[model samples]
Target: MKKVLLAVFVAGGLAFSADGAAIFKSKGCASCHQPTADTVGPSLKKIAQAYAGKKADLIKFLKGQGKAIVDPAKEAIMRPQLTMTKNLPQEQLEALADYILKYK
Candidate 1:
């Protein structure tokens, strides 16, 4: 029974991570932020590096409760996009943060 519960927990975590990538793509995040290079927005690698060891803060930024730390000068360009993420459920927010942080 314990093993079954553990497996379920692990699987659910994986699902969230996968869902995060899907959500990122669906929301047009890939249009500006590349996996390793900056375009209109900072690269995922840059974000991950700036956000390293700060997952909660990343989630807060996604929720619009935190400020931009990656590219403060260009934050205006990304601020508008927060509307798409601000109301996401906490789990999704965490998953999204996890996905971004993984680039580190």
Candidate 2:
């Protein structure tokens, strides 16, 4: 019984961890920000590079607390998108940040 419960817990955690990319897509982030090439927004690689070694800052930015560092000139375009992310639960926010940072 204990092993079964442990397996269930681990599987749940894995599922949650894997939701980052899904959330990014479902939230329409991929509309502008592609994995490698810049479009309306900077590519994920650019964001990941800008945010490298700053996971907490990345999370804060997603939460609408931190300022944009990847492309301050285009912040106006990205600012409104925060509304979609600002209220996410911490776990989801962390997952999103992890997903973005994975490009680095």
Candidate 3:
């Protein structure tokens, strides 16, 4: 039983997905940020493409410090979204950035 419990605990940690993806979905980012197609906002693929190799800049945006590099036209709509995520702790912000960068 001890061994079985250990296995289950290990599996739980392994089963956990990236924190950024969780934050994205919980914060309603996925509603507008699709994987490939544009919706209310640019898709994740587009954001990944535009911010390629610029993960720091992406995190900055999440922190409400960076400009809209992917879609300035829709920046107004996205600006409010920042309030939902900007105050997230640094670890969560990093995770969120990691999740977004994974789209590439």
| Residue pairs in collision within model 1 | none
lDDT (CA) for every model shown? 0.91, 0.93, 0.85
Query: Mind giving the per-residue lDDT tens digits that candidate 2 earns over 1-104?
Result: 99999999999987766588988999999999999999999999999999999999999999999999989999999999999999999888988999999997
Q: Select the stronger candidate by lDDT from 2 and 3.
A: 2
Clashing pairs in 2: none
Candidate 3, which ten residues in sequence have the lowest lDDT sum?
11-20
Between candidates 1 and 3, the one scoring higher on TM-score is: 1
Ranked candidates, highest TM-score first: 2, 1, 3
TM match of model 3 to true structure? 0.83
Candidate 1's C-alpha runs over 4 A off are: 1-18
lDDT score at residue 51, model 3, on the 0-100 scale: 82
Residue pairs in candidate 3 whose N, alpha carbon or C atoms collide under 3 angstroms: none
For TM-score, candidate 1 versus 2, the one ahead is: 2
Q: What's the residue-level lDDT of 94 in candidate 3?
A: 80
